[model samples]
Each structure stands twice: as C-alpha cells, then as structure tokens.
Target: MTATLIFLLLFLLGLFLALRPLLGPKEPFPEPPRREELLEELEVLKREVEALEGEEKKLALARMVELERALEGYRPPEPRPFNPLPVALVLGAVVLLGVGLWRYTLPRLPGETTVTARAEARELKALSDKAKKTGAVEDLLAWGRKAFELGVYEQAAEAYMEVLKKDPRNVEAVRRVGILLFLSGRPEEARLFLEIAQHAEPMAAEGWLFLGNLYFQEGRYQEAIAAWERYLEMGGEARERVQGLIAMARAQAQGGKDGKSVYQARCAACHGARGEGGVGPRLQGNPILKAKEAVREIVLQGRGTMPAVPLAPEELSALLDYLDSL
Candidate 1:
C-alpha cells in the first residue's frame, strides 16, 4: 500500500512540472501609431533613402576613377631570375648514388672479375707440387692417403692437394688428405678434412678409422675406441685387427708378461732396454711405478704411439714384477 502511494506522488509531480512552462504569464503588446504620424515617418524614411543613394553614386564614381589611374600607371616586375640550387641538389643526389654503386654494389655484381675454377685448380696443383718436391714427406703423408691409397703417402698428399687446389669439393681428395694428415701426426689439421669426408660419405670406413686413429693420438682413447668400434659395427673388414688392438690394450692394462715383452720390443726402440730413459722417459724409477696400481695402468692404457698390449693375467703379473725389478 505504501509503495503504491509513492508511485502515485511521483507521477503527479512529473505532470505538474511539464505543464508549468506552457501555463506561465505572457508579455504585453505595444500600441499601434496613428495614420498621420505614420505618414510623417514615411516621409522622413524616403528622404533618408534619397540621401543614401546620392552617397552611393559618389562612392561608385570615386572607385571608377581610382581603378582607371591604377590601370594607366601599374606594371608587373620582370620574372625573378632563375636559381641553380634545385638543379644542383638533384645533381648532387645523383652523384652520391653513383659513388655508392661504384664503392659497394658494383663489386658484388655477377660479372665482377673473379678467379675461375680452372685457374684456382692450376694454382693449387702448383703449390702442392712445390710442397711435394720440397721433400715435405711428413706433410705429404699427413695430407694424401685417402684418394690414392698408393702407399706413397708423400706423393699421394701432393697429388691430392693439387686436386683440392683445383677443386676443393673433391670428396675423394679431401678424404685422402685427411687420412694422410692423421697418419703424419697432424691430427688437428686432419680433423677438419675427416669431418668433411664423413659428411660426404657417412659409410666410409676409412674416414672413421682415420678419425679414430686421430682421436687415439690426441689421447682420446675412449673416443678412438668408439670410432673403431663404429667402423667395425658397420661391417668394416678390419674388425679382427681392431678387436686384437682392444684386447691387447686390455691385457697390457692388466700387467701381463706379454705386455711387458711387447713394450720392451716396441717401446725399447725409443725408451731404452733397461727402462733407464732413451728417447722416452726411464720407466724403472718412474714416480708412476711408486704406486703398484699406477704401473699397471700405464702399461695397459699406453700413451702416444705405444699400442695397448694384450697380456694374459699371469703375464701382466710378471710384467709388473719385471718393472719393479727395473
């Protein structure tokens, strides 16, 4: 009931507000003039219009006279002299573009003079032959076994290098060079060639073997073994040889007598008969032997050109005994 009363009040208030503006008081109107007074007013208005018309005629005459004078006396100045600045700016911009082309763009264009493939190859052959004739046997051997496999590593390296000089993309030459490098104790250089060879021929056992041998020379035996094993796994024909080497290395590590004998035969060539130091360090008093286990480790592990010798368990014990006696 209260809610109904409130709504009724709001509606009545809105209606009243809307009607107020229209219902408000209006202003009073002015009284009309008499006919005689209106006629007098008209006469005054007519005189004022006549005076305005006379003034307008005078203004029009004065304006016409001024226009006639201006026409007789006025002359336009000659066209302003031409300026060179616009032309100079355009020429400067063109010159700058030409200079830029000469310095940067032109050199890189397709027809720019460059060494031809044949010329490059000839130069490479010349250099390789020069290197070969210089009696760089080690260098040749280090660079050339993969392509020729001719056993004359020095000659092969020269020939391969010549081929590479001419055509660096020659896969066979690259592989041969890498192998030669590996054999020549230049493993670091060989790595690049081997990697390229491997990429070119992934299944090539020779490349893997060379890479493995390179790893071995670098004292990365585990890597070397892995490479060799990979080669073997791929059905390389030298599987037995690799296995024998691995076995020999294992046997040597175990301190076998056979390992000692192998060491004496092979290592003695440089290291001396009595382990008293020759081209290599003296093994007898080697601080490494102070630790019984260390002696065995060195023998089995081998280092730098020393092949891992395969020795029986008993042979290893005898080898250790012999080393101790030394």
Candidate 2:
C-alpha cells in the first residue's frame, strides 16, 4: 500500500510539472494593451493638429488619421476553444499505463497469484489447516518447510516455533531455526542454536555445513575445517565449494610455505588440520603414510566426492613429509 501511494504521488507530480507551463500564469492575460487607450492617443494627436499650423500640423493630422485607421482595423483576438477531450484522453492513457505496469510489469510479492506461488500457497494453506486441527508435529513441520521454501519467513518461524514448543528435541526445527538465526545476522546466537542442532543429530550434514560457515566467519580456521570435514563425511553434496573453502582456511592458518603449510593447504580440510578423523580417515596414527606411492596415486586421481588436487612436485613432497611427521 505504501509503495502504491508513493508511485501515485510521483505520477501526479510529473503530470503537474508537465501541464504547468501550458496552463500559463494565474494573473489575467495582461488586458491586451486596451483599444480605448489607442483611441485616446488618437484624440490627443487630433487636438495637437488643430493647435498647430502649416507642415507640422499636416504631419500631426496624418499621424492621427493613421492611428484612427489602426483602431478601425483592430479586432479582439479570438479566445482558444477549450476542448477537454485531449486532456481527458492523455490522463486516461496515463491511468491505463500505470494500471498495466502495476498489474503486469512489476513483480508481484510472493503468495500473490503467480501460478507456482499460488499452488505453493494452497499446499501451505492445507498444511496449516491440518496443523491447526491435528496439532500434529508432522503437519507443523510440513507447514514450516513449505513456508520457508516460499520465502514466507514469518510463517515458517511461527510453524517451527510451534513444533519446538511441542517437541523441544525436534532436530529439524532446531536446525532450521538456527539457519533462520544465521540468515537474520545473529551469528553468535546462530552458533549456539546450530551447535545444539548438531549435537542433537550428528548426521544432519546441512547443520555441519552451516556450523563450518559460522566458524569460518569467526576466523576459527581449525573448527571451520573440522565442521566442513564432518559435513563431507556425512555425504553433503556441495563438495567442490567446501573444498575451496577448506583450502582457503588452511592457507590462512598457515601463513607461509613449508612442509606443514603445504599439508595444511593441500590436505587439512578433508583429513583434519591435526589429522583426527574427518571426511578423510585419521592420519595422525594411520599406516597410510608408509605407502607414499599409493597416497600420491589417490591425490592425482580423486576418489568419490573428492576431486583431484594438482600440486607442484616440491609442494607434494613437502605435504608428504608433513603427513609422515603427523
């Protein structure tokens, strides 16, 4: 409603500016220099002609005659006929254009009649109605998930909160609320909630992913690496982006090049910064380092969700040395 009012005011203001010059000023059209005044001047000239004699008098009489002839020839200019049709037509067109843009050109807000949006709204309505009648956890969850997908955050929150009230241990509700908190910019609070969700359901890969994001934002590189590793360990699908994130975090953690830095940069994200088990198995006490050739093969030809990570020969040697030390 506020947006509509603002658009309308702007349109009206533009119309006023456009019409102002053509409508002219409010003061009365300056009286057209008065025909009576011209006649009075002619009379004065005639009197002067009578008072004078000879050539001057003849010249004055000629000037008076000229003024009289001018007066005789003068006609008041015709007033412009005011036809309202053109103005009405222009105004009508503006209104039609405005209406057309509002109805069609501009994007409609969600839940306001696009086919997909309407279908989703109907589904949500049915879910909401079912939730209200049954007060069932499943119905509430369905409502919350559907609402969230439609970008109806408030409704999603409401449904999730209801679920939480009924079942405080509901990991789905807890995880989604944590995500909502993260999106709403309360990262500290988001961390607490996401931690709770993670502990509640360790296999929820999305919780671990977001937890990693939160830790990364706080510059906790090791924890971020751990969380993302856990996400991958649990079979999260966004492997490539997470691998990049892990690489960047490791570089930040190890500020210069060396065996340790190379290991951190190349392998820490999946295998853990300290090599405690993560997406990749624990290497801290593993026998894998004894088989360097096999490790090199795996590094060159990625297996499963892991992509091949190319490294310079020197860097690879340093990383292997670092792993042996671990």
Candidate 3:
C-alpha cells in the first residue's frame, strides 16, 4: 500500500507538470491598455499630425487611427468558456496509460526496490556492452557477476559461458556456471561443473556449500556431510546453517527419515517450505504427486537439479505418503 501511494504521488506530480500549459489562467481578465491613456495618446497624435506634412503627416494620421481603433475596441475582451472536455480526455488517457503500465511495465515491488532494480538493470547493460567490446575475461567476469546478482540468468550464463570459451580453467567462472546450472534445474550438469570446481579449488568454500547441497539432494549423506564439513572448515559464511544441514544429513543416513522430515531436510531449502516453489518447482498441486511410481523413480534417479535421493524402502513409503498429501 505504501508503494502504491508513492507511485500514485509520482504519477500525479508528473501529470501535473505535463499538463501545466493546458491549465489556462486563473484570473480570466485581459487588461487592455487604460481607456484614458489611449485617449490622451490619441489627442497628442492629432496635434502632431497637424504640425506635420506629406509622408510624416500620413504616418501620424495612421498612428492616430490605430489609437482611436484601440479605444473603440477596448471593451474588456470576453474570457473563453471553461471547457472540461479536452481536460477530461487528457485525464482519461493518462489514467489508461498508468493502468496499462502498472499491469505490464512497472515492477510490483516497493518503489525504492523497483527503482534500484531499474538502476541495476541499466548498469548490467552497460557492463555487458563494455565486456562484449573488450572481450577480456575480467570484463566478462564483472558483467557475469552483475547479471547473476540481478537474476538475469540467461545473460549471466552468456557471460560465464564466454569466459569458459576463452579460459576453461577459470575457477570463478566454472563455479558460478555450475551454480547457474543448478539454479536452472540441471543438477546433473551442475554437479559435473561443481565437482571440477571443487577439485580445482578445494579451498573455495562457497563451492563446497553448494556441492554439499547437491550431494544431500542425491541422498549421498556421507558425501554431503563431508562436503559441508569441508565448507565449515574452509570458513564459509553461514556456518550455523551448514551445521544444521550436517545434522540432518546424519539423521537421513541413520534411517530416521519420516516423509515430511525427509522433504524438509532434503528439499525444503530449495523447493520452498510449503512447496510453493523457489529454486525448484512447486510440489503442491503438482500432478506428479498422484503418480507414486513416477515420483519414486524421479527421486531415486534424480531429475533436473535433484540427484537420486536414495531413501530406504520404509522411508520411501513414508515420503510417498507425505507427497500424496501435497
């Protein structure tokens, strides 16, 4: 509601400025030259005309006639009638345009957030253009980072992929590309790149964090636990979060998985708590939930960013029951 008010205020202010010229005048009074002044000037001109001759006299006479005409014509001009029709039309157009833009072009976020996003978008374009022209790996990396942060995934992919084409061993590019692929719902490919990145730079803590999450999704509890440990050891941020994950992985490994618990521990972080969707698709209302066999197969074999989540038969049965509820 606050955001909507700010937008409305801004729209109204702009409309006011744009229509300022059309508002006409407030007084509606056109003050012509004073009648006494016109008569005085007319008398002075007549006296001058008598003293002049030929062209000079003719010029004076013309001035006197103009002055007399002004005096004659000087009944205060009538003000134009106030016409609301054109103004109403303009208002309607502005309203229609504002509604159209609100529906399509404007961001739904708060006003400040929307403005910041727009600014970042412009910067992203500038960085992209410069990087394209330079063809430098550093330039591309900068552009890729900006794009990724802005959630312009395709552009981010383009920038990172370009970096790979030029420098295949670039650790940052490799790790980030892997992360992008993961987010793009291609966990299999994401894992390959992430594995290469981890091996190439084991000290890269963030890579370990994601690699751990990937492993956890696959139900490789030990590997996930190990990767997360590595991440913690490397002093990756989110220490507490990773520790929680390690605890969960331990539970899963020990066969303590109830269906809802399994979903929370294995999938909630990515797919959203209520399965409304985040990094993965919304599980709620998904038709696949009705297909127990298909859901089981997908969980076991992995699909998209999900690696095979190998639950024990009992745990799997419980998970299927929980999924059916979703």
Candidate 4:
C-alpha cells in the first residue's frame, strides 16, 4: 500500500514539473530595446564630431553615420514559434510510463490467480499415485518418510494413516503419526499414540526422543529426562542436544549444577581439558555433535575402546550440555 502511494505521488510530481513551463504565469514579456535611445546617442556623437578638429573629427563623424544607419534599419529579431510537439511527446511518454508502473506496483486483489507454490504437494501426489498402483506397504512408508522429511505435514500424515490402516501394529507409522499429532498441537492424543509406539518398540530411539520432547512440553521434567536417557541408551544420535535438554529439564526439576564443572570432572581426562582431543576423539567442532543423538548413544553404551563413564543424571546432563558447547 505504501509503495503504491509513493509511486502515485512521484507520477503526479513528474506531471506537474513537465507542465509548469508551458502553463506558467501570463506576465507580459519584457519591453524590447527603445529606438529613441539610439537616436539620442547618435545626436551626441554628431555634436562631439563638430567640436573635434583633425583625424579624430573625421573618425567620429564616420562612427555617427554608422549609428544613424543602424537606428533606421534595426527591427527586433522575430520570436521562434512555440512548438507543442516535444511537450506532447513528453506528456505521452510520462502517461504511458505512469500507467505501466501503476499496473506493476498495485497490490494483487484477494482471489486473483498467481503462480502456485506446491512442488512438495505435487511430488507427494506422484508418490501417492505410485503407492496406489503398487499397493505396497514399503512404498507407502517410503512416501510417508519422504513427506515428513520435506515437512509436508498433511501428505506425511496421509501416508502414515494409510500405513496404519494396512498394518495397525506398524510401530514406525504409529510413532510418526504421534509426532505429527504433537506438532499439530494435539498433545493428549499425541501422548497416547506415542506411548503405544514406545511400548511396542522400547528400543526405538526416535520414538523415545519424541516421547521425551512431549514430556518436556508438559513440564514432566523427570519423565522427560528418563525418556531421553532411554533414547541415549537405545543409540540415538542427537546426544549433545538431548543432553543439554536433560540439563535444562534437571534445572527445572531440581536446582541445576554448573555444566562446565561436570565437563572438567568427567570428560576433560579422555577428551582433553580444552576438548581439543586426547585419548578420545576431539570434542571441539566434532561431527558427532552434528549427530547428537548418536553421540548420546555412544556416551551411554561406550564406543570402540572408550568405557561407559556414567555419572549422576544431573552431572551427565551437565556434561552433555558442556560438551555440546565445545
């Protein structure tokens, strides 16, 4: 709206400026040079010539004759006629330009057609058509997972729903639907569905993660921590972030401890005092942090030659949070 108004104002200003010279005040033009003044000057030169004697007198008389002749012959230069063609052309161009600018700048009205932004939807539709043609569970699940990854919630939900319809016991489908429900703000239903999925697949890291998040949102800090712990134990890769989440939850559950202290005490020996790496892999800018759940699982179960170093839940939480910062 503001842009449109500004364009309109600019167009009006251009129009006014273009017309100002042509439509100026009607004051009479300045008087042309008077012939009488030239005549008087010539008469003065004639008197001076009479007073002079010698070559100066002859030059003066000659100049006086030239001036008299000029006065008699002089006529004002003719005014060039005003040509309206240039102004008309300029006005025509301005009008055309203003119309073009206005057309482009004006806001679109409601219900007006525009290029659609439904690439994901179109892709999902193709996947659905394929699933329908094949009538295969794997194909449906494939579409569901892809849709979820793309954040096409409706399509993901539809695919998952279809999976559930075919196999009610499909834990992955149930877990995903629960996640979608949680995202859609139906927490109570989400909890029921998530619990069912988690119960069916206790070692499913993703399910536990979602359940933990759900518990956290409900202020069930202890439950959230326990769920996240199970997720880590089950080899979830988002360990660093989940550990920080646990630390935050613990702070809400019981007064929090300094995460740095936990890191120095528990991790500094193996991971280095500054997390630059020692006996263990470098913690600074670690790729595992990017896959934090995987990192959490490694911490919980121990990886390669590293022994599982368990601490109090609070301390573990703090340590995870500290490591994530590194």
> What is the C-alpha local distance difference test score of candidate 3?
0.83
Quickly count the clashes in candidate 4. 10
lDDT of 4 by residue, 1-326 (tens): 56557767777877886888868887588754578888888878877877899999888888888787888788977875888887787688679768766455433433322223244445667888898788689999989987787677887899999999999999999999999999999999999999999888544898889899999888787789999999999889999999999999877754335566656666789989989999998889987787867866777788899987666776677767877788
RMSD of each: 28.2, 10.5, 17.3, 17.4
Q: Rate the local accuracy (lDDT) of all candidates.
A: 0.62, 0.81, 0.83, 0.80
Q: Determine which window of 10 residues in candidate 4 has minimal summed lDDT.
A: 109-118
- State model 1's lDDT: 0.62
Best-fitting candidate, scored by lDDT: 3
TM-score for model 3? Answer: 0.50
Error of 1 at 46 (Å): 99
Off by over 4 Å in 1: 1-147, 248-326
Candidate 2: residue pairs that collide: none
- Angstrom error of the Cα, residue 133, model 2: value is 9.9
* Model 1: lowest-lDDT 10 consecutive positions: 105-114
Candidate 3, residues 1-326, lDDT tens digits: the string is 56567667767865885587568567567567788899998888877777899999988888888888888888865776877776777677678768755654445322334556656767888999999999999999999999887778899999999999999999989999998988888899999999999998534898999899999888788789999999998988899999999999888865655677777777788778878899888989999788889988998999987778877888888778877787
User: Which 10 successive residues of model 3 have the least lDDT summed?
Assistant: 104-113
